[model samples]
Target: MMEFKRKALAIAVMVATSTLTACGGSSSSSDPDPVTPENKAPTAVTLTANTVEENAMGVEVGTLAATDADSGDTHTFTTDNASFVIDGTTLSLAADASFDFEKMASVDVDVTVTDNGGLSHTETLTINVTDLLDYYDFVSEFDAEKSSVSYSGQTARHALIAELKNYIGNGGLQSDVDNGELSSKEEIVAKLNSFYDRDENAWDGFAVTFTDAKQKFFSEISSYKSLKDKVAGNDASGQHALWNGESNEAGQYTGENIAFTGWSTWDDAPAHVPADGVIPQKTPHGLVQQFFSQIADNAMENPGGKRYIHGAEQIEANEIPVFVNYDGTDLNQLIQKFLLMAVTYSQATDDYLDENKGLATDNTGRDKGEKDYTKLEHQFDEGFGYFGAARNYLDYSDNEIAGKVKTEEDGRADWNGKHDTDGDGEIDLFSEFNFGASVNAAKRDRGSEVQTDFTKEAMDAFLAGRKLINDAAGTELTTEQMAELLEYRDAAVLTWEKAIAATVVHYINDLRGDLDKLKAGADDYSFTDLAKHFSEMKGFALGLQFNPYSKITDEQFVEINTLFKDAPVTELSEIDEYQSDLVKARDILQAALEFDADNVENW
Candidate 1:
């Protein structure tokens, strides 16, 4: 009776097993289907591994078991293949499956369990799988690759190029350009890639090539002929030629004091010198005085060999400028000029068409359908208007602005203490107001650079050195009077606030251009291909050129115009709003300079 009762209890327990297990499911009625030992489904299962490292024997066996929810059955385990074992409620490991990790490197064993109802589970166990020698070998190989090998092939070169492009496109090293010798293209690139290949761009160890083939082509042409033809030949006027002569002045002369040889004084000198009793010769005094004394001595301390000279400063007043001339040309300027020219050209062409409408209607004598110049008027506005204000701000940086400061003491001492010089409790009256108005006086009197007491005593020396030019409307003003107004306006623009904002804008533009070029290059040629094909080339054929095409709309032009219309009047913030203002200011400045090129005051 006891044996029969135990069997009945076991059958009841087996029947109740299905209700006890939740199958790791939620309380939702739409619960996932369950796995059963009879017909096993791919149910989610978690695997566990255990070892005996905490024991003195240095060996242990790990057991695995599988149970089914819908069918109550003990999982069967096998060990003939050194995998698993089976019992009743639990699956025990066979003795042969025990691991000895003390003497061996590592041991791996695979275990698989199959329930009587047919559910199965499998797992791999890894034990003590490490070696000090393997770690040392990995370290040696990695160090060798980093230090001794070039980053050739697709994967390595792609990474290197991406890093470099990011550094440049993001303006990562702007200080290097400003305060160091890495200013030029070659210097900048070499400084960036210094660790890998310092002289990577050098051609055959003798010459360096520029990727911009146009510049190289001109350089080669000038190398064989005269530089003047290459430079000034861009226009009919010889103005460009003057620039070439000015820039190449250093190479023209071998001796010193070429600086102090003022053409104004030298042209006035006698046919014979009092000391030499001959036509004034290149004397030792002139050489030392002009070259050594007048210029910065530490100019040529870099590998690039850029030098400073006093004559270079004076070249501005002569036909040949002492320094590189700012021609007021860039993408912004180009866009503005193109727009202005297009407008005027369109107007002119429209007038022509109106007068010749009869001929146009008759279709005779070249009716001039859609003049090309007229089409160019809104080229930038139509095609590139999408860039909007952010692009504009990039052109107008805080660094480009001139900053000036004057002390309160200097202001008070010079003028008669009528104006408040430092916003302090002090009044400075004129001798002459230094761009300051009298604080106590309520009329808002404008400041004067010249004295109100313009006596003959003051006028005699001043008028002697003065020269005059016509105003915007072509009306003449005395040079002294013009200088006063111009200087005042210049001072107003040179505030610390203005300079900082302008510098920021300029850098933003630089960064934007870099990013744009990188993107365009990548789009045209995948980075992998570029590194593989042009990695060794001195200059890449990335084609970083600006060419304006037609097919723009009036709405686009208006958007472009708005970028310049709402420029900053004072300080510009560093955030997005200020950035937008900068773009507008840049566009305006560009338009002002380009549209009114003949007007000197616009700059």
Candidate 2:
């Protein structure tokens, strides 16, 4: 009996030890620390479109999955939209109509997932649905169409005539041929070269100046009743005098007032240009601020500004109602996306401004109350740091990926088969994807208003600060102060990035709401109807394999495959290879996100 009791005691001890091990306790003195429950939610929570094929109900549809950092906890998924379902790790739609799936057009949903410990993480999802030509295919078609149009040669003569007129109006060609600015052919060529080689903004300013002057001359003709009658004939003089021959007039006329300047460049030309010269004399680097100013003015003007005036007018003239057939989706979703990108960029600019303030000025032994060191520190933070964050956000979209391909100042595409930025054989995202028939045209293209606006503001502010510093003469910060400034700026950048990430997450949650609506009515859900209704989500209507957030690289695939091997339902062949590249991108982004999260100086 004593021996039996000893055996029973040994069994009980073994059982207790096994239970402790299961609970993640150390078994020996040198064993690692026990797994402590973290109060913090996932550091990088993400939702990605995993599949667009038919679900178990056999309807063609889209699918998304959510992941958390704490792998062991039970998580609950809920959405702002009605009809969403959560069945363990899977969330599926159960809508009741054949049109239900089609009805699910574009929708933004807020998604909140609470772990077993009650810690919650929130994200936003935007889903858009539409049937447009593939972006890459459309780019090819548009380029081809443009080429064919160019080759027709009908507009070649007109183009040359217009160029000559512009040259005369812009003062590119000597208005007074006897004016001795040029003494030889070489001198003329050099002068011409300078005119041709003028920076982008300078060229734009000159063209604008000439165009404005020409408009003023026509306005003057219209204002004079006597001159109007004289120039009313369909003769060369009438065309020259800003009258397009609406009436027949005197038989003889001469082209005298065809080209005339109303005032000096200062009064009519863009701010960057000078009164004496047709082109703006500012440096190439200074053009961005001038561009911003011009854009701002245009936006404020009721007639539309120079920046997007042409684009807006075209849209109004060719407006095609996108949501006429969509009852389940909101068409304004695309507009909202534009607003979101714009607002985010705006906020980023503000953050950059605040961070870069006083970076360029003299702080050495200034007046007692002067904000010396902080100013310079803030400038550094706002300039480089702020821009870095904005760049990452731009990279998230495929625009920058292809921006390299479009930019050719030095005559080389970024994807010339030699420099693999992604080290993948193919030129990744932006290079491959185009807006095609997508509703969100700006998102797919780099150098968009959203990006351009913030970049200009940030750069302008930085330059202003730089001038201040230069003006400060020899005044400088101490070594310690310099180091501190660097640290502060670095921290500020991380904070801005985190804020941007949060905003992006919010949009993703909005998308989840649409999913919920479909799931709520799953019983009668018709995938076709849901898709039809979700037309507003066309921009967000990503295929499972090509989600924007999942910028995959090669290395990440191997890591995730190793980690998720123990999960149920043994289908690795299909998804594993497909997601490998995405995994790499996600891993890099995740690291960056976490780093930013930890740098709490901005808070």
Candidate 3:
């Protein structure tokens, strides 16, 4: 039993036990000397009823009462157990104490009732926690203003990816750097690095910016905790990477000893300047490092190179910025989506949600280290952050989330009263904006006429799971509760994966349309467009291997990758075969995922 704050402290005083006074003439002067009344102790204490519903904080458990012989005695109630406290005769749950019937069915508290006479009586109060099954009612953190759920690191990384993608594809920056508007080659490289590199874990220095009516997103991190040391898995040290070989959970690797062995099928295929070599990476973090350098070195070597590399660019008809390495793959698209999939999706579904990576049995009923959120809460919250939905994600329509909403519809993806939960006038990217998979889910959902509910399903599961964690406050969950948590997690993961697959199919459709335009000798036929579409298609296809729970088999996976050329299909002679291959690959995804034919074609 622990002492609570409301209980009074006892003070010791030396009383004159025997009144020594000159009372020699008392009997002669008065009938008797005034006598003090004897103090009587409280006889017994009882609790009116000791039961409270689960999920209540600081609610009354019962009424504490005492019986005493003296009519003038007023009693003060105190409890030794910190789980409860007494005010007057009412015994209520402690401020930090939340009872979960699933965790603890009952608790015994020792309560002492002290009378004004300085006499006390103690009794054991048994409290029974009643069950509540409304964990599904757990609201969004944004609606609840859950300060404890901190995962700004994930949101910051999402913003960084967006910023970096924008920077590399900027047509103005391309001509300026290539035409000497920027000072030196080293300066260009420095600028590229600055987007991802910042003050040691402070995660600052990106040029990317966003604004709603109320506030601006400057990649703020003052709201986050321990993750400040390291948030994104973009650095080589992170366990996440584009998985290169077979998907094997038991044989995870992250050190120098492993060799980059598996581009086995396309090992001999021609690349613009192969980025291959057994470059000390089996899992491909080293491959990412290689790309990080390759593009920068390409720009540094060629004073007037295209944004990402030194090459004669296949400019797009729409003139959208195209940043690609010499091999014609957009490093921006690949890296951004890669990190989104491997780091964010993998973390939400595979790493944090599972008992293996974290979210252990002991994760509940306490704060995670010095952070305000409990371990279980933080674990899922981090995953949700990486999913990159605004706190009120469901409020926005699909086109609004994809940033493709027309002006007439009054879509509220950006800063508007609809999503400005903070009401600071600007859309706070940390919580009020959508990014990464959440946006992609919206895109895939709206791209096809057959409509999917990927975003809503996943968001609902995340909310419900966190509710489960909340209900079990300050106590480890029972086996049943943990199972329930995992079930919700699985729902979110499955929907998220389906969105990714649909996205792959969506990109494939884009590539096919590009091929058709090229064959028609359409003026808008742009290799840059084809390259962009192909990169997204192949990149997401590559993503299929990252999720540990993915159903994409090795054979189906290899067949899809094998169909994708070393680069986008640039040669006109190959258009027919390449387009055929595109349908084949798309068919494989459609069959494996059981996507509707009309939806795949439309998507």
Candidate 4:
């Protein structure tokens, strides 16, 4: 320890003590008073460590210390810091301040130390934050159960589609006090229109009600997209791209309304559903609603064809009513599939996950009036909502989600993933229920006899993307971060598209079965069954057009439409050629989607 001292002092004294010695002899008893030393500032300030890992706890980086010029002098420290604190000679991060590697890398603080003499010294230090790039995980990053991940609005629309099917086919209106069968065609038409053009107020009230949470479906608030708002890019322009059935700039189908009456096979297939290019001007929702209204009459109306009538009838043994068009199109099946694709899948992959407009929004701040999430984060959440998977989607299996009952040790059965985990008798629609595409993904996967991980892959990508967005809470995404975001979005969107494609193939297999039953001339197998199978196939095939990132190309979709005709050919003699055409369609479908031949054949 080098000797430390205050500045040296100079003094001049006269020998007046000699002259005063005689007089001082008597007063010389008292010695000269001892002089006191001056105080000085401390130096050599430093911290033990200059780096910390992100999300560190306790934050005891190192002790801060300084050397004092005066011996036996002690020191105290303080800082005007945003993320650090000082206790006596010790240092730590402030309780309120946190280090997120993606959001910030270094914390610069000005630290001051004072000696017991009231003198002080100041120095600056930069604590580098280590980037634990893959630190975030599902359970730790998200609010324990759920946080700001609401998609009830989108789910409600899914529920509405189910209720609409019941309303049209199962006499759902007969049971509800606020709703019932219409007295006249005018009332029926008005009520049907409400399904397509309903606002938030009307939907939650009486338009579509969910008595069960398993009816799970879509995400929400201000800037929140309602089901009606997002269906087929629906807007006031009154020209929904999917409804218009117009080709994009590249001459591809825009995935408008697949509702049409047309040829099973033609050499030159047009852009829209009809071979001659006669596209309907109404929304898909509106067209299906018209079908429902026609069912209410129960009359032998042959508006669109001669073989079939627009009335409720049984398909084989089931008493549940099925509505059919003149052209062997099951109106009820078309309603269920078309709306599910048009609203839930369409909005999830096309609008909310869209690269330019949705993901590029600001993520540094929370939603304008909401604190739960940033604008970008909310949009991602909305996209996931449109996907319609429960937050705990990973916990269930394919059989479980498709409502398969479990085999107990005693050979009895019970529902899996349906029990109330929170101990409440009622279900939580967002976390407990599976809706629309989410349910179909599982059902289609399990139904195929092929193992497909559609639900898990899609949900995992959503979780990863959301984690990235949440981790970068205080700044806009960097170029690398943005690239990562797009990658995850692509994975999720592609998986969703593939699940939809698989379902189309699944229906193709069903349609072939329908063809066999008709040819067998079984009294139990009727054109009614053919109508149901064909409509579902057509509706799901049309879903391929909604996503910009669709794996199915425009040309392939055109081929599919060419293969599907205006209606099923119930004429046994003519049916062979249509069946062959369907085989060709199936070939194109499995090949384009990269599906195994066995899966397509079985599904």
- For each candidate, what TM-score against the reference? 0.16, 0.21, 0.64, 0.64
Q: Write the per-residue lDDT of candidate 2 for residues 1-603, one digit (tens) a residue.
A: 999999999999999989887987665547765697666574433544422222122233334344676677777776655534445545444462121122244545566777778877777665444422111111111132321001101111112222333443334433322355544444443333332233333332233222222222222212211111111121122121222212224422232222211111121334432222222212111221222233223223322111121223544332222221112322233222222222222222332233233243434432233423233433343233213222112222233323334555422464222123334554222222221111122221232322222222322333333333333423575565545544543443343333333223222233333344444644543322332223223212211111112232223423432322211111234333423432343344346455233221111
Whose lDDT is greatest here?
4
| Clash count list over all predictions | 33, 81, 11, 11
lDDT of 1 by residue, 311-330 (tens): 33533232211111121111
- The local distance difference test score of each candidate is 0.26, 0.32, 0.65, 0.66
Q: If the candidates were sorted by their lDDT against the true structure, best first, what order would they fall in?
A: 4, 3, 2, 1
Looking at model 1, report the run of 10 residues with the lowest lDDT sum. 538-547
Model with the higher TM-score, candidate 1 or 2: 2
lDDT of 3 by residue, 10-75 (tens): 211112212223334334454565898888888788888878887677887777778898878899
Q: Given candidate 1, what's the lDDT at residue 241?
A: 15
RMSD of 4: 16.7
Q: Indicate which candidate wins on TM-score.
A: 3
Sliding window of 10 residues with minimal summed lDDT for model 3: 10-19
> How does residue 88 of candidate 4 score in lDDT?
75
